[model samples]
Structures are given as structure tokens and as C-alpha cells.
Target: MLLSKASLEAACGRKTIRAAVPSLVSPFQLTVRSLPKQQTERRLVPMRRSKAVSVQNNFSILALDDDPIMISTLQAYFQRSGYHVDIENDPYRAIERIRKTHYDILLLDFLMTPICGDQVVEEIRKFNKELFIILLTGHKSMAPPIRTIRELDIQGYYEKSDRFDQLELLVESCAKSIRQMRTIHSYQNGLSAIVDALPAVYQLQSLEQLGGTLLETAAGLLHASSGYLFLKQSDETPAMHPQKDPELFCTFECTITKEQARAQYTATVFPDQKTIVQQNKMSAPLFDTRHSMIGMLHLVLPHAPQYEQVQLLDIFSRQAVVAVHNIQLHGLVRSKNNELTQVLGKLRDSYVDIVSVVRLMVDARDIYTRGHSDRVSKFSRRIAETMKLDRETCERVSLGGLFHDIGKIGVPDYILLKPDKLTFEEYNVIKRHPDEGADILAATSFFRDIVEIVRQHHERVDGKGYPRGLTGDKIFVEAKIITVADCFDAMVSDRQYRKGLGVSAAVHQLQQGRGTQFMPEAVDAFLSLLDKEHGKEVLSLYDTLPSTI
Candidate 1:
């Protein structure tokens, strides 16, 4: 259904109706200036004369209807109110335009040829859910059911009248809503970009990679056409020079040379602590962990950015500071690591000889305990290997096992070598060896990583055994492995006070102690090892060792 002739006459005076363009003329060809002087006089009325709609320059509208006059009136009124407006008489053409172009609000007529407004809305809802739509009907009764409107997400509906006061109010409400939605959408996108860019930034190992990643992420977030990143050369040196000039490290579609960026950094960005925006360009200072200026970032955006974009850029700049500082710290760590590696190489032989002498001294003091540390170290390493632990962990566990009983050196000879069963006081004295061993190893940086294992090797899974009553996962896995190996060897190896529990008895003890005194996984791995052919050989080797005092 098209606009009635009487309604058209009422909208524009009769003389203006006679001047209307031919229906065959395309709607796109019509403009406000082409309308008759009297037709243009019929302007849309505002809901409140003093409080008119405030439209943004980019806020736009698409008016779709079968009647040319109705489309013309809407276009003229919206354009006059400072909005960008387009009109389409064919629903198919309107739908195609909506698909290709972004319009903030759509003004749709309820009646049209071939298909109605509801059908057109259904087709559009298939692809675009964000477009704000308003249905215009000749009468309230002609409007689609409320259910259809809700399912299609139609934002508003209005009865067509001689004056467009109600329609104007609805458009104002939609414009405000669109502004908020766009702001939220932009914020979400900016946060997601920051999240995605940080992993790439931190993964970079070199200063060059760091600079490029920081520049790319900042530029992409700001939608800048080009940018330059300048970082301090002194960050690579052992001692930093705060006043030194920064070198340009990266450029993205940038025409400026290094000298130009350096000049801008010194003249424009260095003195100002706040971000500076001039027309289409922005300059933000890069800071270190101490909040000292370490560099500058310059970007050429497509237009002067909004307050929200500036805020997001500020956030990105703070994270970039962390990235830059991490890169500097990494460089220092790499240099120090090289020096330490060389020093450790020189001390390697001497360090081994000293540990060997200590082991011999501990064994020489007790005939029954001879070869005990070596056996424990080998057994612990085998358990670690059976558990598929890393090479470094296996090595650490072996070292830990070797030194696990070093604390017993501090015990009195009468107590350590006593052939009689230990009273409660002597047993209490025995419990202190783990702590003493941890202290001895902690004195050397070489044994730093294994100190916890040495300290907790006697700890029980049920929190019953120990220098410290650590339970379950609180015990280091390396410590747990050593605990299982140490307990097994102590149970099966001879001591002066009693006959050694034979291999079968020791296995029974281990099975009884599972979960109550030992980590279940460690026990399982060690038990699996004992079942192997090599494990039988290890047991035989233990049997061949001297058992006499």
C-alpha cells in the first residue's frame, strides 16, 4: 500500500503536490533543493521545542518506503537536523544497501509492494542483528504484532501523521543507544587486541623483536596508518644512562627517518609527561618500571582520535613499558648467565673433590653405614628415571640423596655407632640430620636447587615423619623419590643393632607403608623398578656389600 493522494496533499499543500516529480524518477535522484518551495516548508516537529535532538556528524539514517513523497520528507527533515540520510523506494534495493553500508538507524514503512515490512525485517535479521530499526505505519492497527516485532528485534514503531514529532523522538532515542553500543563494542575490541598482542610481545627474546612487536600492537590498537618506535640504546648496557638519546628501532609504513624521530623525541615528547595529540598525530612517552621516561611512540592516525581511543592507547603504553623493561632485564640476565657459566666451569673439578672428601669422612666414621650414600644416590636416580623425570631433576635427586645424611656428621659418635636400640632421646637426635644436611648444602650456590630435597627427604606423605611435617603435595617430588629410596635402603641394609630386614621383608614394609608414610606415585614407580631384571641385579649388588661392623 502506498501513501493516499489525500494524505500526500495534507502533508504538502495542494500546489506543492502538483510540483511532485514523476513516479518513474529514481528516489536517489531526488534532493531537498529539487522539492517545491511549499513542499520543503513542511518540516518535522520536535517533541520539545527547546530541547531538539543532538545528532553526530557520522550518525546516519536509511528511509525505506514505496511512496517517493514519504521518503523525500524523511530525508529532508533528518538532513536538516544534521544527520547523513539516504532513501530507497524498493525494499530489495534497501536490503542490499543495508548489507553493504553501515547506517545507525533504519526508518522502515509498514506497507510496501510485493512484500510487507515484517518480511523485509525477517530477511534482514538473518544477517544483521545490530541495526536499529523503527517501523512506520499508516495507523497503529496496521503495525505487525508485538511478538513479531520482538522476535525480529524491531526497536520502535510509530503511526504516520501529518507531523513527524513521534518519529523524531524515536530516532533521537535510537541515536543515543547506538552511541553507547559503539563505545562498548570499541572498548571490547581494544581489550581483546591487547590480550592477543601481549603473548607475542613477551615471547620476543631480542630487543629488535620487542621494538617491532610493541610498535605493531600500538599502531593496530590506535588504527594508525604509520608509526615509529624509539628505544634507549643504554638499556642493552650493564649501566643505564637516563639522559642518553634513544635510537629508532622500528617503523611501520613510516616515512620519517631515524634522525627525525629522534629530534621529535627530544623536542616534543621528552619534556612532557602526558600524551600529546596534534591534529591526526599522537606522541606518547614510554616509561620504565620506575616511571622514568625510556622511549617514545609516534603514530599517524586516519583522523584525530576520540577520548576513548586515547584512553586505550594509554593503557597499551603501560603494558608496553613492562615488555620493554622485561627485555632489558633479559639482556642483563643473559650476560650474567654467560659469566657464571664460565666461573662454574673453572670450579667444577675442585667442587667435586671437596664433596667426595666429605662423603668419605662421613662413611669412614661408621662401618655399618659404609657405601650407604652411594647406594641411596644410585637407587634414587633409578626411581627418578623410572618415573620419567627430566635429566636435570634426575641429577638433582642423585645429588640430594648423596648429601641426605650429611647432617648425621654432627651427631655424637656414641649415638651414631651405638649397637643397642636407640632410646627416644637418641631417635630425636637422629631426626635433626635432615635440617643439618639442608643447612650444609644451602651454604653453597651450586647446591641451591637441591636444598629443599635434602631438607624434606625424610618427610612423610601422611605428615607423620620429618624434620618438617610436610604432607602429600607439599613435599617436592624429588624429595619424595629420595624418601622412598632412603627408606628402602635403611630397611634392607645392615645396622650394628639388628640384622637387616631381608629383601622380601623390606618389600612387605614398603607395601604396608604406601599412602601412610610414602607418596603413592613414588612407591608405585620404585615397585615397578624392583620388578625389572636390572632391579634384581641392583638388589644382588646390595647383598654383596660388607655387612660387618
Candidate 2:
């Protein structure tokens, strides 16, 4: 049976145990009955309230008992002690109240009608294992089994008595325990967030970008107001630290040894921040698996870091090493790729210049052909542009035109500069120049794409031209443009023994040859190009060329 202070005094009249002042050695102490049956060692919990108790005053407590008197007593006492307290007289209703509200501690009466205190704790533990529990019972015999107390994680047992000092001490202890748990949980969450972001952070390819993100994440997770990252050239050599940026309020450049990197301790103040207020600092060395310490991440927090925070920063340092290695690898690959591109570009330019020089040298042998390849290159480019070819294709056509007659360099001077009509043997010898030009360029991989164009430039649509004359659609489109450009320039320009035919006559010759000697599409584009602004410039430039006598 439960009895309150007033009701017990009225029933027993100063003779009841509920109203008597308890005889004790201290304000709160465990009786010998608190000893567990399984162990001889008694668990001791010191409960002398500190002169300066720093526990959270707003902490909440839920007190449950079938006696409304007992519940009211606990609510009044804890409420006066600066805690938020809720009271419930039914065990089932207590479980429901706990489900709806969050409490730091639970005070439960051990003996109740319908449901005992152990059963109430069992139900609450199912949903709220974190709430600290203390049992209050009138009879030691009515207390739950020792196993039940341990299994339900009950923190204290207060035999019901007139004095509430023991229960108050238990509540204070629970508050301190809850505070410590929340502090540790906060550090765990910060570490989890940093771990989850590693995939994206390491994916950054640029050194500057990766460094900035890594330092920012590290400092932010540690609640630092300012920090700096220092990069080393190598593990043994001095680091090439950056000049202090205006952004960092604190910068630390002291080198950390391998032993220091492994230490999970945070200093109260780093050497660099000695002039400023003493604040917490975490330093981590970024080193690869090769044991090369390449950089360090230093963060300056406003206060001392917890043990968990220091340990988490150490883990971050190990991950940062791997991230820095990947950034360096990406940088190396990017540098090599750019170098290869520049070298290939220069080689291609020099190769084209060599082709032009060869054509000019060959043309120099005959006065009438000095600038013949140059004019052919300009006209071919105009035709390609009129056809709306891509820039690379247009440039390829121009290059093919410049080298189209390069094979003439192999012809004897007597046959090349005859200055008269050639016999069949001499004409046959001249017809081999296209094949010769292709063979000369075939040895270089750089000119592989243009070889077929150079070989087929002289072939005709009707298959009557030289060097594998079987043609039509078989001829490269670029080869067809070169053929039209070559013939058009030859007609309008001076030859060794004939006068220059004007643009109109040259265009008429192209119209007559369309679909038989030249590609119809190529001929149409070339004629259309002659009407445009650039084409008019080509026409006027050719008019200045020295004409036949």
C-alpha cells in the first residue's frame, strides 16, 4: 500500500516510517541491499550535490506512481529545483506520456496496483532506451529482481521514505550523463558528414579547387572560425608555403613529423596563434600511402576541442592524403595531354610548310609556274568555303591543292620545261606525278589522311584521267575540289607558250567539263564562289599575274 506524507501522518499519527526523518550517514547513500547477487563488488555512486552544480537546469523529468500524492510530491520538489517535471498516476498512462514527450530522466514507483514499476520500465525501454530510470519502492522485497534492474538499465533504486534527498541526487546525476552523451553524438555526426562527402571532394581534378574544398570542409566540421592549409614539395624538403591570404585569420606553417601526424591530440593554442587569445587548434598531416608527407591542414577553433573532435580530425587527415594524391595525378595527366597537343600542332604546321616549299621549288624551275601552287591553294579554299565544308575539311582541301603538283619535282628538267607540246611518252611520264606525290607523303603518318586526295586529284569523273583513272564516286570529295580548282587556275593563268584566258572563258571551260571531267557539285560551288566578295578578290589578284607573251 502507498502512503503520502500527510495521509500517513493522519493514519499512523507520528508512528509511521513514511513521515519519520531517515537516519543516514550522508544526504544520499546506497544501502547494503543495493549490492548485486552476482558480484561481491558493490557499485558506488557518489551523490553529494556540488556547491557549483553545472548541470542543465532546463532538463526534463517524468515521475510516475499510482499514488497521486507521491506524484505531486515529486513534481513540486523537482519543479522547485529548476527542472521541468511531469507527473502521472497510471502506469499505462505513464508509458503514453513518455511516448509523447522527451524526458532526460524517469522516476517510477516500484509497487503499483495492476502493473508493477518493472513492467512500466520494460514498456518504456522498448521505445525510449536513452531515458535514465530510477525505481522507488516501499518494501525491499517488492523491488524488482536484480536481473530486471540491470536489463532495464535502471540507474538508481530509492526505498520509499520521508526524505526525497536520494531521488534528487539521482536526477542530478542523470542530467550530467545526458549532457555527455549529446556531446559525443554531436562529434559523431560531424565525422559522418565529412566521410560521406569524400567521393565528391576527391573527384575534384584541379589542385586549387580540391585544396580549397578540403580545407573549408575540415575547418567547418571542427567549428573553426579560421584556418590555413600548407602544401609541401616533398616529405624531406622544405614546403613551398603560399603567402598568407587575407582570408585566413590564423596561419600555421610549422612542420609536423610522422609521429606528430599520428598523434590524436589537439593543442590549446598553436605557435602561430600565440599572439591572439589562446584557442583550440587541430593539425593533421596529409601524406600518401608512400609515406610522403606533402601537406598539412591546420584549423583554429574558438574553444578547446573534445576528445572525439580531435580523433575525427586525425581520420580526416588520412583521407586528405589520398585526395591530394589523386589531385596530383590528374594534374600530371592534364599537363602531358596539353604538351602532346602542342607538339602535334607544331609538327603539322611544319609539315604543311615543307609541302608548300617543295611545290614552290619545283615551280621555280619553270618561269610560267612560279606561284602556281599558291594560286591553286587559294582557289581550292574558296570552293570548299562555298560548299559550306567544316573548317578542317576546307583546310585539308587547301593543303591538298598546294601539294597537288609536288610530284613534278621528280620529272627531268628537260621534260618538265620543254615549253612545247609533249609526245605520248613525255605525256605518260607527266601523268605519273600524282602517284609519285602520294608515294612521297605515304611514309609519314602525319600526312596519311591527305595521301588518297593527292593520289586521286587528277582522276576524272568519266575515268579518262591518269594514275588509276577508275573514278566517279570513288574519288574523295576533297580530291574533286582540288581537280576543279587546278584546272580553273591553269586556264585563266599564263602557261609557258599560251596567253591567259580571262575568268569568263575559264568558267565556260568548267561548265563544259562538268559531270565528265569534273564533279558537277564541285563545279557549281566553284562558279558560285567566283561571284562572292572573296572570289572577286581572287579574280583581281590573278589579273596582275604576268601573262604569256
By TM-score, the best candidate is 2
C-alpha lDDT of residue 162 in model 1: 49
- What tens-digit string does per-residue lDDT give for candidate 1 at 499-536? 78977888888889999898787788888877766677
Give the per-residue lDDT digits (tens) of candidate 2, residues 1-549.
544422433333222112111121123444422222112111111211322333338689889888776677677667767788888888898899889988888888877867888889899889988888888766544567767877888887776654566666666677777777887797779778788879868896555666777877887787777667765444332222324331112233335443453342233233422122224866666565666555667777878877777777777777777776666666566667888989988887788778767788898888777777888888888889888999999988988888888999899988888878888999989999999999877766777888989999999999998798867888888999999989988887777657678789999999999999999989998888777665667776565565551
- Model 1, which residues run further than 4 Å from truth? 2-56, 80-84, 96-102, 140-148, 233-248, 255-263, 267-274, 352-549
State the weakest 10-residue window (summed lDDT) of model 2. 37-46
The TM-scores of all predictions, comma-separated, are 0.54, 0.59
What C-alpha RMSD separates each model from the true structure? 11.9, 9.8
Model 1, poorest ten-residue lDDT window?
A: 16-25
Which candidate leads the pack in lDDT?
1
- Model 2 has how many clashing residue pairs? 0
* lDDT of model 1 at position 321: 79
| Displacement of the residue 363 alpha carbon in candidate 2, Å | 3.2
